[model samples]
Target: MSRLEVYDLEHNYVTTLANAYNVGYSKEENQLWDASFQLPYDDPQLKYCRPLRFIKIYDNEDEYIGEFRIWPSEKKKSMSDRQVKIELLDCLHTLTDSVLFGYYQLNNYKTDYVFNWLLNKQKNKRWIPGRVDFQRGFSYAWENENGLVDALFSIPKPFDEDWIMERDTTVYPWKISLVKPQTEVTARIIEGYNLKEFTVKESPQKLVNRVYALGDGEGVNQLTFKTINNGKAYVEDTFSQEEYGLIEYIWTDRRFKDKASQKASTEGMLRNWKKLQYTWEITALDLMKLANRPSNLAINQGREIKANELRLGKVIELITEDNEPIQFRILKESKSDIDDGKANIQLTLGNVIGNTGTTIADVERQQEINTNYANGATNIVPYIFDREADFSNPVEFKFFVDDDVRNVNTCELTVDTSHFRATSKGNTSSPQTVSSSTSSAGGASVQSATSSAGGASVQSATSSAGGSSTQTSSANGSHRHRMFSPGDLIGPLPETRYVAYGGGFVATGSPNDIYTAEAADNHTHTVNIPAHTHNVSINIPAHTHSVSINIPAHTHQVSITIPGHTHEIIYGIFEYANLPSKLKIEVDGNIVPIDSTSFERFDVVPYLSKDEDGKATRGRHTIKITPSDLARIEVQLILRVFIQSQLGGEF
Candidate 1:
């Protein structure tokens, strides 16, 4: 009889009981076990549908056989007794069948980290991390529609390995390992031992020499495949070509979107195909009889094995009675007993064939290619800068890059300038004229005359009134035409006549006669009358004659003329048509040339600090794009890059 211990999901111990259980596992289906027990009809603790309760089966020597999770049970009732039939499943059921309810998105997270995160979400302490050494990071998204098991299997593991769930008896929690075949064994029957039964079988239906593994392609949801062949050479002896049957498998993970991964998967399938061409079934009892002494009994030497020694995916050697040694891989195993002394163990194994020539180095190289070049850290996302930018002020643009990027030398940038014009005008002064007048006058005159002459004269004399004395007449031989002077005709001519008479008495004989006529009274009257008449006639008059002179008033005029005008100016106009001369570009605080406005696939290496050992440190990195002396015109920029990390690979 085997000792069975029961526990809850939290690993809290329940009760140890003596019972019989039949446990089995198969590659095609989930592992399961069944047991039955009787309890009192009114037992208070017995119940159904209790989740997470489990059972551990151990043999009589206190070695572990297997662990099982308990499911709901069916109860059978009699009048005095009741029996409960309980079914259990392998520990893997929690991973595969349990529903995961939440949103899960992995953004450039390593595959091992993602796996650990999923397990932690279950809130169960049973499952813990083991040998999860994958170097690549992946991006994925899922809703509540997937199980943790599906999500884990969907990731691309490095080296084309498989995940195996196992428990370390010394530790409290179960562990999962990304593993390959690491151990081998041989099963042989002693010649004088009791062997219950053994059988060897070969099935041609399982033989394959060619394989095609389908995987993710470059396009969205696209499918692609890689093919592997055993040989392409013809047989020299038979002069014929050999052909092996084809087997196809599809890897639905989107992470296998590279040629290297596809090739590695196809080769892994070819390796499996070469190993599992035949099947072997072997059953034996726990006890056997010794050949020499028929009465003496001995325990079977190779009947019972340790749990760790005979687990699934382990390789072992089996030699049959015909003395043929066959290397086989254990695909299924079962142990059963019914509370009897005898215990039976059964195994389903497959034959191991030659190697498929696929090595760990090849698989690792393929993994590196996928991680570094294809579907890895390299990225291209479209972005746009402000086309209508204010160039006068400093125009700055920003973008983000992953911390894993090794060197950011692979980048590109581009730009363009704007168009249009402006103007203004003013005025200062106007037009004018002026005039004046004057007048003056002056006059002067002079005359002179002189005369000297010889003259002939006649003389006459008259006497005034009152003197009737003598009228004198002079005659002389020498007198020439003499006229009487006023002084000479003085006083009286009579007196002259008397003196003449007296003197002439003695005088000369020449004289002759004298006449004395006196009209003195009449002459004096006439002279007075003449003076009165002349005074009467002397009367004068004053008068004015008609005269005319004409003059008039008037005006004079002056004028000036002028014309209109204007002025113009331009603003924010660029110096050059194609590229601005005064421009500077700084990326991460480093200056770059702006000779070309449009940079086609230009590369910029980001400045990353290193340790003293000259190894690059991984963290958040910054890239600042600043354009200098830009204004009024439209500016544009475009960019692209690649990222890589050394974190997980080194560990």
Candidate 2:
């Protein structure tokens, strides 16, 4: 037989009230236990008792079974019988009312560390406990507001790491441990004697072979743990081409932000599924023959054996009637009233192999062991080609142009000169000279008259004869050079030249000026004319004369001669069968605007010439992205080389 004992939260013993019927308590997984008992209205102890008082259950041997706290309630009467229904809650119930407040931050801290910190924090705030045990640790970061329990559970456990919470029997305190599965079963039913009811269920629908994990990346918001290389997905062909069927399971765990960590987690999940593809559920009830034996026991020799070791998180192997063994982990346990201190023990078991979950370390090791390329698959081959290559073929290419390449359409040349010449002259001519001559006939008439007078007088004949002998005389015409001396007035000065006193022409003299000659005109010339008939001959001939001329200082006309030269350049044209409507560009890892002056879409000969190469190299217009955005961007290039091909596409 078992009885209930009452005590205050301070551990002080209290008197037991009468009529303690309906005294059983119920405990649920991860929840508080509630127990109820009835007390007679006439009991005086009820007046002093209050809620929050503790209650303990003891067997006939006075061994403690469990304990709970009193729940506040009002007294009531039923069927003319007055009784006080007192509610009691287990120790875990105390935590439900303790609200966590303020900000808390955990960086790379283990779950156990946080649990201990929470316990200490609550203990400082008047929440007392007998003992506490937490042995598991999880690595993660927690920030912001959350409840104590919420924050504790937020720390994710790797697939392989297992943790459980249960009250220690030896001490009245909570115990959390990284428990393992037991090798043997603590209880069983043989010959179906003590077995009251049993049910078995197998679920194959829950089988899954693939898992995908998602989380927040370092800078990006969302990231997935899918096999990818160079921004493209690398699907596992073998898994998709499975012999049986495809069963993919996608799991989103935002706790992991690192790629390696996310990969490990997904791998762990897949490993877990591969270990146990389906789940088996078994529900059983057992009845005991011996009253003193523990509720948990194994069947043997037709007599019930006590197996007090059975507990949550423990593994058990059951032998069926046909001697087939089935392994299960105890998931749930419950006790129900039958009659007079006897109880029915119900158990729920699941087909979960012990220690089968995958660990992060194990996942990481597996990833290292697996080759990057899938089985029987080759790596991608890159093609490189010049920009002028024929891309008519359907293959992609990495086309590039050199910086020296020029697009003639976008170039201009200019030339300028400073001097030139044309034709002009200034001349001086001499004035014509006029000459006159007079001739005379003479004494020939006197000779003829002398002969007639000869006889008149002999004495006069001598004089007459002399007179008759008088001869006719003539003067010769002569020419003399006109000389210019000092004090000579050279009238009507030429427009650009003047004669000086020394008989030399000057270019700096004033034009059309009259000047007086100096008194130094010492040289003279005479011209004479005779009265004789003379024959005259004149000669005039065309000829050129060499003369010294002076010119004024002036500039020559401007003339320009632009040499014929060419602007050499190379251009690149990019084409894609399916190019993105929009694109982003970065130069030397620096993001630049995608406007007309910088980068833009183009068709036809999309000229990547000297103008475009001014800012970057053109060997291979390599598109580079940060490690974080590798998964976000997907672009591929294919190369083809040809002699001379027209570019006709848009990028």
Candidate 3:
């Protein structure tokens, strides 16, 4: 089982929570570690727990999960006999509580500059921001954003790298810095194994085959694709239209100021949104502790991965429905209860670790693989198919190799002559010799021969073969002059001519101070802006409040109705001291009593489970806080409700 250690607002170790119930935590909007726990009555260490308390949770292996802090009004205690609940937010929440003022721009700044900038803007006077003596080489630019935390997180990474938040509460001013997320260690989340219930949601509800892409300006001046798309402001996918009809959408991206960019983004959106897609909502078991592994399963090398290695943002393998392994990053994780001493974890897998093939399915498997591979599949680790060796004489094969992330097409191999010479190896033959086209009557095997030319006689000697020697002479003595030259005689060099030096247009002065673009006619110049995206937000001024629920302990059950909308909760623990031998406390119709022990006090922790969907239905649920009157017990039940407007939701 995991344990929670609490500390004073100053971070001085106070007490180790001996008991808690309805314990759960999740990663959401901020991706910060905010945990919830319940106690029957507030523990003396946290009698009126509000905020500013430090807490840390660890598993059975004593490995750190995360560090958290209790902000103002985070604690709820049932006055003596009632239920008490407390929650702690990550120490990194300090930035979220702070906001930046005025417009600020940094051209080429490091991570330290961001940290110090945030430290200076933070309004939390109670805790001094930590110092950053080091910085990352990556430079990021920021224009304006009141949310300093989100602004810092929005920093662009150099490559496919990621930025992460860290904190060290060991010192007075917590040591914090922005560093790259580490994925050095990872565990496998496979089907029929550690992976449990999961939902593969594939829907085409948002499919749009036609898009009216809009950018920049407003109304009449809005940049569009007309100039680039044959005088058309909208783009469409003919193939998608043929299948899904003409589902249209208006894609507005203010980042693009020109028609070409807007048009490009519009076409891209059309292509992407033209088809159905799948989203995975998976629930994986967090069996991080070695003891949690089931001894029955025969785990093999590389398969028996320790669950402890499953950290947020770390890439891990998840076996898909086809039993094919897929690596995806963990975007969100929530732990509700300890099932058989193992935490029940629900995870939202995001970003494929490797190429998951471009297309999800096709009429055929190989065709699907080929098509997706052609489109763009990544990190396949060099593989080939349909290339058999020594099969056909002239074989055709297809292979894939990493070349600037492009896939080359099929290639053929063969040796060719006018007609088929050799069909197989070792079938070649040599050619015979033949006579030349020009030959004299002195043939082969002729030992001697004689010839006469120009009134001269020639004799030939032989050695049992034809070998001739001939001589001829002719006198045609008509010879001419060998060489001659005419020196300096090109009409006397055209009679030297010269004109007086007339200095044409010479000046040494600066160009006119006022200048404008000169063009043949009136035309619009393309205004270029770097390719980027804009984030939309609604400013909801920051605020805080407190919840006080005081109900006395009774023998019967009392109920509290948690509204249906976006509502979830964490119930704390109930501790009773010096209870009589027969005294007991009742919770939700069940009695939770400590095992018989010599200790004078009993720390009672209820085992509460969340609905499979990780929510409470819209209705009244019993929160039984009954203790035997004769026994005289004090129960602290902590309830932390995460409410989103009229609807309640998970924390």
lDDT of 1 at 357: 20
Give the alpha carbon lDDT tens digit for every residue of 207-240 in model 1: 4455444443233223243212232211011111
Give the Cα RMSD of candidate 2: 27.2
- The TM-score of candidate 1 is 0.45
Better of 2 and 3 by TM-score: 2
Model 3 bad stretches (over 4 Å): 8-12, 28-30, 71-81, 107-116, 123-147, 157-185, 206-275, 290-308, 320-323, 338-342, 353-651
Q: What is the lDDT of residue 90 in candidate 3?
A: 74
Error of 1 at 300 (Å): 18
Which residue window of length 10 is worst by lDDT in model 1?
A: 232-241
* RMSD vs true structure, all candidates: 25.5, 27.2, 53.5
Local distance difference test scores for all models: 0.46, 0.43, 0.48
Q: How many clashes show up per model? A: 7, 16, 30
Q: Write the per-residue lDDT of candidate 2 for residues 1-651, one digit (tens) a residue.
A: 456666665556786654456555555433445666667877776764587777776534454556777887658877888878887776555554454543244444554565566656553233323332334343443322233443344343443333344554234444433234444555554435444556665454545665555553221234453433334212122453375366666555544434444564455455445433433333344334345555664355555544433345556666667658666666655444322354455566655442233321234323322322111111222332222111121112234543222111211111111111122343343343333333343322222222221122122222211112233354344434334422245544445544454565544334333333333323433434433333444444444334444454443443444444444443443232332233233333445344321121222123222333232234654332221111122233332211111223356
